[model samples]
Target: MERVRITDDGFTTLFSTEFNQYYHSVRGALDETQRVYIELGLLAKMQETNEINILEIGFGTGLNALVTALEAQKNNLTVQYTTLEPFPISEEDVSSLNYQTGAETDLLQKLHHVKWHENIEISPNFSLQKVNCTLQEFKTSQLFDVVYYDAFAPSSQPELWTVETFTHVASFLKKGGFLTTYCSKTVVRRAMEQAGFKVEKHIGIWGKREVVRAIKL
Candidate 1:
């Protein structure tokens, strides 16, 4: 896939035609991640728990992972984060996506050099493991506390949005655990319901009308 830079909401955003839309926007993309997904959903759940184990479906641009790590650092929350990326981007490509001005270069380096295939502690409370494999092939013996289902739009990769794959993911989520997605399609909502999740429509960000947040019941 080819990456192109575009200006969206005052931020220089990067996107691949393979995945629709911009990577992020200055005005609202980061806000969407921080407010809707992280704050209202993920962090809210973590507040009631002593520790959290997060599984991210698509580690695109490493934005969600970074935010999670930063939150763990700030809140002294213990986190075990596992991220999956089938078509992982190169280090240079990730570096180019750091459009946020004044961001520490060390975070970028840490992001690029993080060990893959094994759990590595980046801090006392934050540990990360990257699996360089597609979702269909990965195997896990543990259930997660939360899941960030940030795959490409359903139209771009329908297979990942199917009930079958979601069922597979459900096997790895503890009872009462939550999964958040930026998609609100009928098929996707139905798939989550079929996978035994209690699905609900959530407030969307960045000019979006709706999103989906589900809890495994």
Candidate 2:
């Protein structure tokens, strides 16, 4: 069973007793999502086009997907999001989250309740396909405009941050597509470069110094 805890900021995060890790920083879950993935990854791409396709590596808590959906709705942009997660949280645990408090809460619930492996339209402009698989097992020929590489740190799950792993994911991105993550480790950045990404560093969210944004060129 997965153990979870609510942060001081009132957002829920998964605690991996096995890994001795938390799915997100205790500083603020929503803040980190907005800063790293939504603002840097999605919004940056949104500036280039009105429509976007996004691939997410770790779909823990479905927070990134929900925030992306809300941002797309706000900007009136079309989004096609595909996410991979080998272990999904239970519906009961999802229901207990206090992430969203208003009309957005319904949208968040819809995101969790929707069927996996099928592209389901969550709203007029946001469509999602949740794949229940690991990154190595995920296979698709479709290309994406953005990727949210929110995997666990290399210290805990080093294999996921390797050149081989990034090469696999980069194969699915269109030229100029961007992959953003909260991880800014030099080895990870080098791995992304080895995978053919033109990598750049950006200011990270609170408590973290830097993050990475890599471009498929």
Q: Pick the candidate with the highest lDDT.
A: 2
lDDT of 2 at 61: 87
What local lDDT does model 2 show for residue 146?
97
Candidate 1: tens digits of C-alpha lDDT, residues 151-191: 77777788899889999999999998888887888988999
lDDT of 2 by residue, 1-217 (tens): 3577776666888776655778887777888899999988999998899999999998878899998988899899999999998888888778767777586658778888889899999999899999999999999989999999988888888999999999999899999999999999899999999999999998887645898899997
* Regions of model 1 farther than 4 Å from truth: 1-12, 24-27, 99-104, 206-208
Off by over 4 Å in 2: none
Q: How far does residue 90 in candidate 1 sit from its true spot (Å)?
A: 1.7
